[model samples]
Target: MLFRHFYNRLPLQLLSIRKHFLTNKQNYTVIKNTQTYHNYNIIPDVFDEAPNEPLIIQFKNGIEVDYGNILQPKDVLEPPIIQWEHDAKKYYTLCMLDVDLPTRLEPILRSFQLWFVGNILGQNYMETGETYANYIGIGPPKNTGYHRYVIFVCEQKNKIDYSPLIKGDLMLPRYRNHFNYKEFSKQYNLGIPIAGNFFLAQYDETVPKVYKKLNNLSLFVTPLK
Candidate 1:
């Protein structure tokens, strides 16, 4: 029973490496924010270029996020306060994309929409904007390497048309993958992300509860591979 409990807590990478020594402090490490976005390929993967500035993200627990830092899924279960500077006259949109859904190296499910808010003005005016997709916190499966939760704050020239853009009920996981950086930019000319930042997360003991609470729906469109 104890072993099974411990197994659930161990991330996929640790288990794959055969690190059974839970007592060894050396096995635990933190990804420092000092690392550049290139280290994680955020430049080409999520954005054409580096972010104009770092995004200010904090959870209900008072832990603030910095670029490339690692966090636990349970710690960020709620929609975080996303802050950025922009001209009040211009509308903006914020998107959180989980590039590594099922795995880090080969994301068969390339991008999973974590959150999306459109038509926001300066000062994090989310209420005025459309809540395209209500936030769903990170819940990477128990055996995927660390997943990157990338936030891209794009400058919107105008309000988005919901018609052809949004499909099925976004509240459901299947439809939430409705938007992506490439599509939005091509269609609306939203322009490159003005500001962005991301933090990494991995499967943890809290993930099981998250799945149950959310109807056990994952990035899988249906019973996929």
Candidate 2:
């Protein structure tokens, strides 16, 4: 019985150590009240896994999002306009994930999915698609640090049946994190994204509002002093 108990406790001990290591290395700096800039030439982290391709994504407000452009929470209130090389008849999958979770610190560091739309016509996010998940604007908690919102467009070999992925009832707030985009892409054979872009969002007044609008879901809540 003692051996069995020790084995069971081993995983927890390793996890604790891992979290401690990551917490020290993870960059969780808060960028408050600073001039926002856009770098259209930046490259996203996801590109390291796949070859970079030209995929243009622009917000309705006329801002062209490249790899890692610095954008405000208000900048993404609406969906962005897409421009791809494929014809309109082709279908693709649109996915967004937060890559800045602070390791596996309970809820501290987990993937936050901002959007996921499947079976959409090429270069158009407006029509003929299954909305597996609705878009939620960035809501990084105050003092929680900055986050990178990476958007990807995966070209499907064929029209994918999203029924399997939709099995779990959408869980608000929690759905924003604990997602495994790498696994999801591989499981569904979605392959690497043909085009991708990313933006950074820091905690601000708009963050609380973004959380409130999303049914008061917040992974990290700053306690009132």
Q: Which one is best on TM-score?
A: 1
Give the C-alpha miss distance for residue 35 in model 2, angstroms: 25
Error of 2 at 124 (Å): 2.7
Clashes of each: 0, 3
For all predicted structures, in order, the TM-scores are 0.76, 0.70
Candidate 2: lDDT of 9? 75
Estimate the Cα RMSD of every predicted model relative to the unseen true structure.
Answer: 14.8, 18.5
For 148-188, candidate 2 gives per-residue lDDT tens digits of 77777888878888877665545456545567766777888
After superposing candidate 1, which stretches have Cα over 4 Å from the reference? 1-35, 218-225
lDDT of 2 at 42: 21
Which tens-of-lDDT digit does each residue in 33-107 have in candidate 1?
A: 214677887756666656656678889878778787899998998888878778888888888888876677767
